[model samples]
Target: MTKTLQKTTALSTKNGKKSPTDKNLSARAAAAQIILQVLDHGKSLSALLPEIQPRMKPQDLPLLQEICFGVCRVLPRLEWIIRLLVDKPLKGKTRIVHCLLLVGLYQILYTRIPPHAAINEAVNAARQLKSDNFRGLLNGVLRRFLRERESVLATVDKHWQTNHPEWLVNKLKKTYPNWRDIIDANNQKPPMWLRVNRNHSSAENYRQRLAENGITAFPAENPHALRLESPVSVSQLPHFAEGWATVQDVHAQWSAILLEPQNGELILDACAAPGGKTTHILEQAPQAKVVALDVEENRLKRITENLARLNQQAVVICGDATRPETWLPQAAQQITGNKSAVKFDRILLDAPCSATGVIRRHPDIKWLRREQDIAPLVEIQHQILTALWQTLKPNGILLYATCSVLPDENGRQIARFLAEHSDAQLEPLPFPAPQAIGHQFLPAENGGDGFYYAKLRKIA
Candidate 1:
């Protein structure tokens, strides 16, 4: 009902004491709250994970994430099964209960947990929410699901089983001829890719190190990228804290590769938060003068932290990309140590768009993003592109990139930019740049995430 009640219901146990089921109940409670926040309260799962995970025991955190991620991955099938079972939809204050049910069903259908224990824990989880009255109700529904599990699951053909939202499915169908392939790729577990810092060690050497540690990995076409056979935590990575390598998607690692940063050129990474590309650019060309700019201060803080960890330096600025003049002067002064005018020799505008490409990594995007959101995102992208283009020197290059497969945000957006700006010319990329006005890489294509890259050179 209310935020206070929801928090209390999620955390408090009977008699205000911890029981042997403490870990189980807490994990379920955290997962249920996260699902409710994302599905009902319109929050980002990525944003919520950091907030909720710390409150959970370290041993239970993985289970919590598994439950949350599993529910999101098969949400469409779960919703259909839920509708068939429940007499009516969960409403108002009872919405969190619905999320809890989804978590329970997720465990039963997907995880290796025993069905009885899953159902029992789910029933007990309701007690933690002070919905003890619904304990029997939860148990009955879950047991009923077990009885009809075979028939219910049989009706879930691929058409009805897709985890993507309708708007996204329709959009993808219109954009790509092989839409089903794209959907299939998005429903899978994303491979973990490592970007080996050339400054510290070669990718081959790192691959050998991984072998020594009994970890299996393969080199990517890009010499810097290494795709692990299985995903592991950063702590498990060798020289991770020492900055030898960083976890990045193979497709994402291409941004810096395509940008072609030279050793002495001034580079701009607009909308650079979390600094993945910002740090990559420096890693590629350690002597390059680079500026990392983002609008949010907190996100910008992450950029600096990433820089520090990688032992890289950049003039990090928190300012809107649409209003570059406000921060560009300060950024230039920091790079050159002179309060004088400066223009970028190369730029990487990793424009903000509906992140449709990495849906597998973040299934919640399919639920959170709406079709109408695209037009406004295009507007923001256009504004950022126009503003940032002004800062590029004549004959300098700018690489436009997005983790989105949407045509309107990728190819069409670049087409429109080319039509409007006579000074901008499309430059062929080193990799197989797709002939559709830019390079478009589908999800898992060449073992990379679905990404779009358009290299443009400012005509002198």
Candidate 2:
């Protein structure tokens, strides 16, 4: 049964100074509401975070994020424990209190938060929730969990312990015969990667600046990419406001490299909101005429902000890619200096998919996405591919990419496209990623997000 909770409740103020108890209660309350929103309403953490974080005490924000992310990451295991410990499930309006228990348990099991403090705060959170009836119940369940924790956790099914849903496990097993590595990768924390803006500084120069700042980073296979030893805020990085660097995964940087954009050529970044690849394409070939397209107008603002910060330029369009006719003509006119139809020399179709690839970075996706999402996503990808192919000039290349590890969306999808298009020819991609049809990058242990890239040429 699905249940939705209201946004977080406000913390009570006492003399403009929130006591330690108040702070802990507020953080737990906010975290519980955030989890309930995602777990029940299908809302994304990315969308809910900015809304909820500001309402929390500045010191308590990080704890709130940790609790929310931790609860989602280990949700299956937490639920298993809850089932084993709690005799009856909390239902309806009372469901969020159950989320409070999950957060409390996560802290006890994973964080250094003291067991007594975690339990007390979670129980107090019921007061903030106005569900005081659950307070004693919460305390009892958590204390019992503390006593039985080791034995109960030892008995958890290995699959649930990993916290991935059963359907996803089956899907990954079918597509990747040896799926343990992929699951492990998804459970592990992702590394911090930075892309040095070539227009301002080389990777070597950026590395030197980082060293001077006492931040250590190692260069990746791509000269422009660096993997930081640890993550720091962008403000901590040198020349961040001047756009000397950007935080992009090493695997994502490959799209611009493989696109092989050239100076003065016209290029289109379809599905390009938040403009990382669009700006990278321009950075690689400064003279290229770039048109960045995305369906969401609100997100297009982020693309513009990145361009302005990087001191780069691109024609940003907000229109549905499936109906390319609405926006393509204007893009063609901008490139050709006339209203005549003109094809782009390169197109980066970063098609939307299930995004099972970067689950570590967005743990909520592991719970939010379902088995039924794949077919519709594949259909959307196919429509985008066919429409964008019409915009690529003869001999021009279209690089199809997704942050998905599924074959139906990666290789099989591309193979079907190649068969249907008489003029389209698939080119072999070179890299360490496993491939039979196109490149499939499993979520890496240390380096990159799971990604897929296939280059197609229009021979006609």
**lDDT of model 2 at residue 201?**
92
RMSD of each: 4.6, 4.8
lDDT of 1 by residue, 318-376 (tens): 88989988998898788778768799999999888888888888887777778888898
How displaced is residue 304 in candidate 1, in Å? 1.3
TM-score of each: 0.93, 0.92
lDDT of 2: 0.85
Q: Which ten residues in a row have the lowest lDDT in candidate 2?
A: 1-10
lDDT of 2 at 145: 85
lDDT of 2 by residue, 1-460 (tens): 0001123223234578853334434888888877887888877777777765555678988888888888888788889889998888988998988998998999999899999999999998888877799999899999998898788878775443557988999988887876988888888879999999988999999999999999999988888999999989899999999989998999989999999999989899988977899989988999999999988776799899999999999999988888888987777677677778878899999988888888888888888888888898899899999999998899999999999888888999999999899999888787654446778878878879999899999996
